[model samples]
Target chain A: MKKFAELLENLIYSPSTNKKIDLLEGYFKSNNTLENGYALSVLSSNYKMKFIRVSEIKSLMHSKFDKTLFELSYDYVGDLAETISLFWKSNMDIANSKKLPLLSEFIKNCENKPKKKMYDYLFNLLDLSNPTQRWAIIKILSGGLRIGVSEKTVKKALSKYGNKELEKIEKIWHGLNHPYNNLFDWLDNKKPEPIIDNFKTFHPMMLSNPIDEKKDFQILDHKDFVAEWKWDGIRVQIIISNDKVVLFSRNGDDITESFPDITFFSKKNVVIDGELLVGKNCQPSSFNDLQQRLNRKKVSEKIIDEFPAFIKAYDILFFREKRSSKFEFFR
Target chain B: MNILDSRLNIKPLNIFIDPQHPVEKAIISHAHADHAKSGHDKVLATKETIDIMKIRYGENCAKSFQVINYGESLKINDVDITLYPAGHILGSAQILINFKGQKTLVTGDYKTVDDKISTPFELIKCNTLVSEATFGLPIFRHPNANEEIKKIITSLNKNPQSTHLIGCYALGKAQRVINLLRDSGYKETIFIHGALEKICRYYKNSNIKLGNLEKISNLKDFDFKNNIVIAPPSALKDRWSRRFKNKISSQASGWLSIKQRVKQNQIEIPLVISDHCDWNELTKTITNTRAEKVLLTHGNEEALVYWCKQKGIDAFPLSIHGMKEKVEK
Candidate 1:
């Protein structure tokens, strides 16, 4: 019955309306009648999943209103779940409180008095059964909390939590954004493996208006500053090292899904920085020249050459394949 | 159109991108490449614009650009000209020329307020206000910047580990975000996308106090727990976010407020912040300028002109090749 409700809801919305669309669809597919605010708790925990949108639910409700269960959920879910779906943003506590009142009463009175009004009021109303429930509140308060707490502040606070000097942990916090999941593994080993270099890092443009610009760019003395064409194409970093090929943003993200062909080449480990430009004929072209390929999740063999992509390699940061490797220099 | 015309003439040439090219003094408003396209290697703007042109386009392109600044009057053969800040992007200026005693304000893509990117657009009183309505429609009204920033701060506060993947025009957007977040109360490490960090450093070296933001290129460290990460929209979604499974994303853009889905789709959240003036601001600015006539071009200029006409203000969107027009579906 719940699966039927979800499919009927799916018929009304797409993944674009709300990120929560998927999670809600998943909840309904579980084929279970929710008990004692279990619906709100599950959806609240859906933040562990994703957010919900009232507009999406509204569309679902509008069509499903005639059904007995759709009409019945209104009593159990209350105004909070409806609020999030309509506003494109909402408090999980508020949604949870709509199901449970006494808990919401406690939070509104104490823990979150001066700072967070609405969130506190909402959390006080929900079912708080586990100590991990604190993670739940912190998650909603922290915008869909997932994991790997922002270790910078956590590093500072770690003096209390993990009993370590703030500065020492901060050093390790620097590498916190790295891709490897086994974070402490690098520290645990004697010869810690070098970070995977295959991911591309972006360098955001710090542009200057001509009127406010300096007399000239302070060139990093010829050797230090190697200038490239500043290709009109988009900037992208390609990392291929440790037998792992990944594309990362300057923000340190792996974009291997977007440009597969760029990584499909040579199975060896190498990290190179360059522009992701789609060329015409053989030369790099204007930024608009590469617009056609921007959003494609995966490029086909035809696209590989049709745009005839090329990167004007300006910097070489990691290459186990080459002499004078960065690892040897720094370590 | 073959993309040629001579309007309110000035030192460095400015483009209006009209199908029906007006034959007037070719007045160059400012030095941005979008407004400063050239023909035959000889163009006109202000001394400042030409000076800027030299720095950006080089001597060849710069040598061809004519120079003119505010109030430095010169009759380029037959066209009389003047320059003032347009404030749409950086170094932008509105061109005002008195051709045969009839004044026309050629606003080459303008904004009303001063920002980290550039100065506020100057008010110009003219018989005919020829403007690029980048934010022309009534719906394009911009909100109070301070209030908007406050909302941005709240959104950030709500999401502790949010990586603000702001969509920038690359030039101005990056600089604006850096400037806005420079002294923000949040003391987390602010990492700039290497490209943005470099550009921001240039702005700082130029004497603008853009606060201290660490460049991602040099600093090989970050803890998402406290720092604010700024990147273009393209890198925020897809594979760019895989490394950190918990990071939330948001875009700081004028369009963000209007197109809620853009924020919803690109990142988990959206902050309605932008460098461009919104429809309300544009209308208010045009009305306040009290220019007898208004010419609008760019994003929904027709709709903007219609709105102005409804209120009994003479306005119309000039046909131009700005990003919106060229990139429209």
Candidate 2:
């Protein structure tokens, strides 16, 4: 946990992308798969583990200190775990060991514990572990582990050892779970790669680059260049696969519920990338109409009728595995 | 009661307290890097502080160096000034200035607690007092230096297999911790990084024995077991620390009273050892000075100002636009 905490600290402080990649790679190479996979999961956006709140941490701290003093410390530090860790009176003789439990074991022990028990557990753990390790445990369990490691960068770290492209790991990332033993086994060449079922996963979306003036236009032949009129609406991808329709934003965030009308397209095993506007006609509508029904967990029937969303297809990446299946987005 | 400026050189006297900018005549209070800046035309400080400045910026730190002693009075122009022990560091002093029968005291950085090294703080009666509030918040109650050192020693005994990398400011804190550790009866030679060589040598030259000090050079040959290494805080977090196979990082600062900072720096062992006065000391010093007016500088000024108002003492926060207190090393 100390090494893992140090790795997180290093990653957080490193300013350059290359340095971040180096730190991640170094950590992954030195640590076991359990620790690496958990770290990756902590970095992922889907993980949500709030075993204890800052309020609870504060209450626990009050047990050991004066209430007003703890409040002052909390206000001064501006972080819950940090305030507790700093002012925590430690009896150095009480089961203090340089060795800490593995990251996986620590997480497992924390799960299913009662809140009162967890308070004691965490207090004891904070007493036993050093400040850095204490911070790591609190950060991980509080679900505030934002060290700037994107999902793709994690796959890139995995790619370094396997000699595989980052896309290969990203393809199977959504289907796998944390502490990815099978993923590690495949990367280690101890087992074959796991084949994820049909479009159940999110393929890392291909991003467009800006056209450089001098030579980009020169290399592009008139026949090869395909220019579509750009729309001001939110860019989206409509994935129709495995008898299910899923509408994803340009960044691969699932937004199927936001545009239920657009999910009924009569297509299967196909992913079409396009712009989503709030109009039914072939012409694109103003982005103002789309804004009314966006970023909402639930859209009312009246609003949906007033601003109906539609998608205008621009490019097709995968079509039914039988026709044009062997397509590479980057190449 | 505007004495030495907390800001660098708004007035010429600021150069005396903060010598970042040169001035004609400067009366320095202490030898902490923030207070004793290099490149001054003329510096008037304690004899020990001048020695520390000479070691830091070389013998030519000032065009003319005048050594003053505690309780000694010196007259420059129409100002009558006296130096008093602040009990902050080895050569720390509080300046007492009197002009036309009114007295004002400028304390660079001070603490009431006895560290058994520097001269103890003596109360100086003045009409107005300018004080440092670095740990002025009521939350910042520093633990005893001896107790904090015992924490380090206990950890060292517990984790004998790992090297302890103690992070501190090179000039004062590194030497203070080393002295405290030596006084705790740990006879082993403490390893020090190259950055601390100059200041550590200065302490040695001042007749302070730090007990079997070794300079860390070749990592491959250095022992990693049951050893304590003192280096600048920057060295603790940088690639320099990776050489120790089994190492624990520790930071000694007043800021360790705030936990998030300790965790943010990734310090394993936090020693709440500080040279500046904590909240109680700040208030006590204000009361002890018998000052009618108080000026707070640096840390948690607003809170101190508000507290002073409730106590019926005229107080204000003396802040400069671009001046930052040198809390971090």
Candidate 3:
């Protein structure tokens, strides 16, 4: 926990991307696999556990210190987690005697527990942790690291650590769970690559890079390239296989829960990449109209009718359990 | 009996303590610009502060100068005024005014912790305390100077190919940081910005042992890698720092304790080395003074005032000029 806290602190202060990657790589090199995996999950915002709510934390702080003083500190700090971490005063002797819980230990202890039990566990853990550790714990509990590193940055660090291509890691990233022991084992060359048997799992989407028109156009043949309308909508992958369908965003986050209307497809074992846009009668609406149907766990029937979503297929990566070649699809 | 007619002036004597505007008679607290201004007809401060003012504003900074050493008392009208070390910068003093047997100490930006370059702070007991609340809120807990200094050394060791550019205030903070680096056994020649050269020379002339200093402008085609350069905060983001390749921008100030402030300034490395007192020090000093009433001045005065009222002490936030100016320096 101390090492993880230090990494978060360093990442917050470090502004350059290269320095942030160095910090992350250094952390991965020093920590164990389980702890490193949990840290990565937290930094990437993939792991979310609301063991303690902000209101509960506020009540606990009020119980511990003067309400006015806490409010003043909170106003001055402008961050609730940081203010609570700094204002929290526990016996240093007792706190130092007990070692802080590991990132995995904390996660497992709070996972699947009742709200009251989780609150008690967190309260005691906070008592044992130092200011920085408490800060990391609170931030992790809140599920937003906000440390300026994107999920892509975390993957870049992992790539640097394992000495593997980032594309390879991204290919199997959505299949891996937290505490990725097998992934680390494969990276360390102690085991073979983990196989994903689930046919509905997301495949890494290929993205385009900006081309220098003057420099890049000179070497390219006009017949080799295909041009399409660049839609101003979110990129999504629709995977439909034997009795299963899933929708994944470009980063491979499962968004099947958000758009149920788009999950119904023909009974074909295929993965198609396309733009998810709101449209009417074969014409796409504005990007703003599509945003109303995004990121919702329970979409309303009214919204589904008002802003209907459809996928404009850009390319087909897989069909009938066989990967389609890029040139073949383009032709 | 009213002690102060206004926030800046002492009643009955018509003397201003650290007044922003020039006046006929001014009792300057320290040489910091907000507290010590030029064009005052008569200026009363410690000898070091007088010299600093002379260096900053030239010989004609004031019509006449009255040097009051620490612990020395001067009688003007019915009030007897004395000076004590504030421990903020070299020659920074807390003005102690004794009027009609009532003592009011005006702390012009002070810190309780010893910076080693300035005189150690001496807590004076007074009936009414007029304190500067620059770091008045409880969130601003400045870490130890040695520990914060160690961060720079650690970062330097980790990235040996990069130049460490530390942005600090030109006058006092720059000198204190240099002294701290020297104390930490950093034996290399410390490079300083051109703006810092004069004040650093002043500190050296005052018998502060800042070992082996070199001006950045004097050297040409120098390898700045694995080296530390101290500059004014403005130079950190400006073209002046572009000369050193792969430079990491760091800032040493109390405001760096807040994460948002560091992010807003885009400082890559934040060192929480303060020249003013933190929250604990401010509250402790207020309580230790045994003062019945407190007049809070400058930064976050509202919080300190609320705290004093809770302690059953009469406190008021004094709305003085120059309150909005940055008080970290």
Candidate 4:
């Protein structure tokens, strides 16, 4: 946990992208399966330890410290977790617990505990830990690890050990749970990879760069480039394999439930890349029309009929061996 | 009668000095935003304070101006008013109101600590004193400011390859820190954010020698390593700081005295420099004023009021909803 905390601190301060990747790669390389898996959960903001909140910490602190002093310190610090980590008074020796508990062990203890019991458990842990470790614990429980590590970046680091591609990691990512021991064993080539068919998972989609204004058309060959209208609607990758369908935004978030009207496609193990549009007929509508159906859990029938879902399929990748190389959207 | 209520309850003399709301006539105690507001029909302040008001709120800050200086006494509706140096900022002043042989003092966000750039606070003998308690608690005893400045120099000397990004308030703190850096024999050019450029220019126009200062927006491909860059606290944490390679974030504010504040701000180094009076100075100022009664405004008023009562002075907390404790910035 200390090493992971140190890694997070370093990653937060390390400005260069290369340095951040190196730090994460070094952490993943040295840590064990459980540690690396839990570290991944925290860095990706998916840690599931929500037995405590910032308000609870503030109230607990108010009960312990002077009210005026606490309020002044809170205003000055501008962060609740950091304020608690720095000012939490403990009578017990912090060094009594010589060896810090493992991340998995902490999470295991937090499972299904009542709010009161969890508060005591967390208070004990906090007392025994240093400021940095305390900050890490609070950040994990609060689940807003804005230390700049994206889910894609974490997967990218994990792929380095497995000799696996990003899509393979993303495909199996959602199917696994916390402390991914089985995934680690498979990555280390000690066991076969676990496969969960018909489960919703995300896939990294193809992206395009802005056109360069300085490049001369005379020197460039038109045959090598494929030009398409730049649609304002959100880019989506619809993955349909084994009668299971999931719609992924460009950032690799699963939006399958938002546009359920377009989820009932054919059962081919293929990934279709296109723009998520809205309107009747084969022609496209404005992006404003599609905005009505987005960011919603349950789309009403009236809205579905008024702004009907449509996908302007630009390219398709078959689930063949070389499916990664088959992206011809910008060919 | 309360000094704050005098602006409203005292009719005929509808003159407000540092009133929270816009009034027909406002006597600004200082150029700090909370004290000197725009939309006043007439403004009475020191020349420097009026200039600062113009810089902050433009020429339309007041319809008319009556510029007063330190020790200059004026009569406003049978009340004798005088401005004294508050030493909080470049143009900050304390208003001393004398009515019918009774004197009441309004110290608007003052500091007694001696500063290199701003005027030092002068104690005024009065019957009653309304003091700001921005750092009123007993625990807020500030350390030696010179020692704080040496810390920045030492950090720069140690991390010669990293640019030390000093985060400070744009108005007074930035100018004061830069001037202190100059006085400490830091000969290198200090890069500044665009937000500090106008205030820095104002400070320089007032003949405060800020040596070798340049705005970062003007410099292209400039070497920031081993250089000092002063900016607003907000800019140092944002994407703007990414332009410099190997930068260290340092906040130069009195709030940095707290370990929690230092950690929360993500500051690598915390310089405990302030423009407001600390607990000791606040007590010292009250004692030196020789006032029979004391009125507290802003900060932990209740604690200071209790301390005053312990000293056998008639003390009360002034519940001025219009006044803001100028903390940090």
Candidate 5:
């Protein structure tokens, strides 16, 4: 936890991309694989267990410390966890205890606990941890790390440490679970790559790059190029396999729960990359209309009726359990 | 007693301490641009400050100059005045005003932690204490200087193909960073921007042993890998910094303690090396003075004022002209 907190602090302070990668790489090199995997999950905000909420943490702090001072410090610091971490006071003996739990152990303890048990566990954890560790713990429990690191940057660091391509990690990222022992084993070459049988898993999408008109036009041939309408809606990939269908955003986050209307597709076992948009009678609505149905955990009937979502498919990467070749792309 | 008359002045005697505008009789605190301005009629400060002022502004910075050493007493208009070490920069002094046994200490900018370059701070008992609250918040507990300096050494060791460009204020912060590097046993020749050459020379002339320094403009080749370059904060992002092959932008300031500030400045390495006191040091100094009233000046004065009120000390923010905004120190 101390090492993870230091890595988060360094990432927050370092604005340079290369330096952040260096910090993350050094952390991966020094820590154990299980702890590093959990730390990476926390950094990328992919952890499934949220042990405590922000309001509960605030109420717990108010119960222990003076209300007015805590409020004042909160206002000054402009961050709840940081203010509490700096202002929290605990018994010296508890804080100096040598039996501190590791990052993986802490996460394992918090999994599947009752709310009351979780609160007591967090109280004990806060007492036993230093300010930095307390901060990391609170941030992890709150489910928002906001430490200026993107998921891609974490993958880049992993690639640097494991001497693999970033695309390879991103290709298999969404298929893995927390405390990914198999993933680390694969990275360390101690075991074979994990066979992901879940065909609903996300595949890394190829992003488009801007072309310079003056320089790029000199070497290009217009006859060989095909231009498609650039949609302003969000980029999504619809993966339909066997009996399950999933929608992934650009970073491979599963947004299948939000766009239920787009799940009605032919069962051809295919992966289609397209722009998720809202439309009526084949006329696409404004991008603002599509924004009304984004990021919803449970979509209501009225919202689905008002903003009916559909995908404007651009390319089919896979069909009938076979990868589409480049010849099929320009067909 | 009037403490404000168009500028920060003492009534009945008419002495201005670090007044922003030009004044007839001015008691300059330090050679920082905001505190020690030129065009004063008669300027009184330590000899090193006067020399710095002459270097910054021309020799005609003031009509006449009076040099005063630390702890020396001088009588002006029946008011006994003395200077104490402020520990902010070279020759920085805290003015101690004594009139009819009513004492008020004006600390322009000070830090309790002793940086080897400046004279250490001394606590003076006074009736009212005027302090600079640059880092007057509980969250701003600065780490040790040696620890912060070790970060740079570690980075240099880790990335041997990159040049570490540290952005700092030229006067106090630049010299202090150089001195810290030397103290940390960094024997390489530290490169500096052209703007820092004069002030660094001033620091060197004042008997501060800053190891070998070479100006960035003098170097013919651009092979500064694994080297350290000190430049003004503004030059860190400008075209002047593009000369280095792979430069890592870092900043040395108290504001870097805040994550938002570091992100806003795009600082790669944030070294929290401050010239002013942190929250604990500020509160400690104020309490040790045993002053009946406190007047807060500059950065985060409201927080410090609230802190003082909680401790039953009569405190309020002092709004002085040209001192409202914080200059990069």
Candidate 6:
């Protein structure tokens, strides 16, 4: 009668628009006999939708049905684990490729072994007429390919991300579970603090007793000796005034879209403090080559020049609206 | 066996903090304050060693301790016990017991891969193992703890204003070298310890991935240079690394005897790495858990009970982290 919840509510109003959903391609009839694996596992278990078409679950595996609600909807479509397939591979990459779309008609009607496993994916069939029987339970329940749905579970399924009195957004969504853009401006309340502060705390990071025997920059050069070029990685700060920019890491919170190209000085209200560095032609690059750009909340322009990051400047603390000195912070 | 010896005989063994012991109970297998000690009155750990014993003992130590998470199952008067995870640190388990049908696992210090702090070791069959010779001689294993912290993160990519510290263990060696530099693929920015800063902010507030992190216990505004610091194996020697004289320190336990934590924690090198469990995962958990019987305790338990009875099994070197005057075999 052509109505599996009006074709999964018209494929959930476009979550992956058309990557070949083919509902039954030009209306059913592929050697028509009408069985359709218990209405395609009850329209893929009441709309979690992913019926990657294998000739309609193989003509309901040739009728004579009642397979105990198709073996409990094949363990509810083999529960896509690994954090629900990385929240559907970050809001829908729509997978189906590690080869299984019909392994020669699912190796002769699903063997018997593998009574139940779950995570490392591999079931071997209670038989749905094999088309890599549901992408081999989503590649053994999301073990590889850091995909989908987690920006902190889409910020608790978007009840408007958050803000106001929160016990620290449940302690910053308990160590930040994905969702970004200053976590929707700190769960919607407007994130601010962390203009910048990373007090070196302690290390040989300042030791040099060799500017090659102090060549007259006198009195320690008015105690100036501000040479610079230590640049390893991770010092962070970018403030941007009234129109609000906020990203701070010298022990403050807000990280503005996991370093969206350190907001390349967001229209500069100036607080500056440098060294995020992930370089290429101009030297210094290795915490495994600037860890191919960290924690991303979309920094693509082809990963911003194949991971091109830079900060270098020494210190500023803020300019126009004023507040400078570690003595007008070096130059 | 009558539902397994009335569950070991009603809370059977004792041994945990021990006070002329009569099952005052202290089961612990991993949480390392040298196997979680906190004036116990009762404890039976494993919710990841009661979450590293409520971050190194307190919150009335999980309110007189009683967790049991990783693969739960317990019964004292009949001693069946359970609790496996033991990738070492962060509820680091490995207790396993049985008693009558005799099982006995223990290994409060373990590691069968998966370091970047916790979760990866579970293959424990057991007949009696106990383990932990810290890196039990035979030139002490360890090399890939994410390729030795990717050689201090590829030397902060050729020295981006260098500051690196590293010396860990304010509890589970500085949140497992900040989850092995946030899972060996450094998201950079890391600086913990006010006793490893609030148990690494409650294990990164328990989503547990240890990357893109931060916490140098706010040093106010001393300005040390190109930041990385992780501190504590007792502040890597004094005046807080002499107030950052181009700071570098490093130790990151697994007791850096890499011919001395690269010249005693001056560590221009040394990420040799160690979340315990070495010498081929204590000789492959005494040869794939067909465990004939062995005991060997922490660090140098007489060179792992003389190398697990020179490999013929049936060994014994229990000192429980030795020292405090209790050595003799």
The top-ranked prediction according to DockQ is 3
Look at candidate 3 and tell me the lDDT of residue A229: 89
lDDT by residue for model 3 (A1-331), tens: 7778888888888878888888899888988878877777787655565667788788878887889888988987878888877777766567768988788777777686787787677788778877777888898887677778987888898889889899888877777777788888777777988776446578887788898999998998998877898798999998888867788999888998888777655787888889999877647999999889888999998998888888898988888867776446545
lDDT tens digits, residues A162-247, model 2? 77777778777776766677887788687999777646655556667898779798887888666678888888877788678888
Instruction: List, in the given order, the native-contact fraction of each candidate.
Output: 0.00, 0.15, 0.59, 0.00, 0.47, 0.00
For model 4, what share of native contacts is present? 0.00
Q: What is the C-alpha lDDT of each candidate?
A: 0.49, 0.76, 0.85, 0.78, 0.84, 0.51
* lDDT of each residue in A63-100, candidate 4, tens digit only: 87777666765665666766666566543355445656
Candidate 2 colliding pairs = none
Candidate 1 has a DockQ of 0.01
- What residue runs in model 1 are displaced by over 4 Å at the alpha carbon? A1-331, B1-33, B38-40, B46-62, B155-162, B186-189, B221-225, B237-245, B321-329
The candidates, ranked best first by DockQ, are 3, 5, 2, 4, 1, 6
TM-score of every candidate relative to the true structure: 0.47, 0.67, 0.94, 0.58, 0.88, 0.26
Q: What's the DockQ for every one of the candidates?
A: 0.01, 0.16, 0.65, 0.07, 0.38, 0.01
In angstroms, the error of model 6 at B157 is: 16
**How good is the docking of model 5, by CAPRI class?**
acceptable
Instruction: State which candidate, 2 or 3, has the greater TM-score.
Output: 3
Model 3 clashing residue pairs (backbone)? none
Q: Residues B1-329, candidate 2: write the lDDT tens digits.
A: 35545452324233355555667767788877767777788888999899888877889988999988999998765678899999888888988887667788888788899877789988898998888888876657787788788878997888789898899899778988999998889899899999888888878887776877888984558656889999999898799888887787888998875544655777667888998888889998898888989998877787777778778999999884345765743
Among these predictions, the greatest TM-score belongs to 3
Model 1 per-residue lDDT tens digits across residues B1-329: 11122332333334332112222323455544555544333455646555555555566652354565655676655566677777755556676666677676767766677774666777877777766655443333345555555545675676666554444444566666656665455455566665465456556666666666775556544445535667756666646545544465666666543323342354444455665666556777778777777767666566566667777886655554333362110
Off by more than 4 A, model 4: A1-33, A46-105, A125-136, A148-177, A180-200, A216-219, A227-232, A263-265, A281-284, A320-331, B1-129, B135-160, B163-249, B255-329
Could you tell me the lDDT of residue A317 within candidate 6?
A: 59
Q: Is candidate 2 or candidate 5 better by lDDT?
A: 5
The TM-score obtained by model 6 is 0.26
After aligning candidate 2 to the native by TM-score, how far in Å is the CA of A177 from where it should be?
A: 2.1
* Per-candidate TM-score, chain A: 0.43, 0.85, 0.90, 0.80, 0.91, 0.22
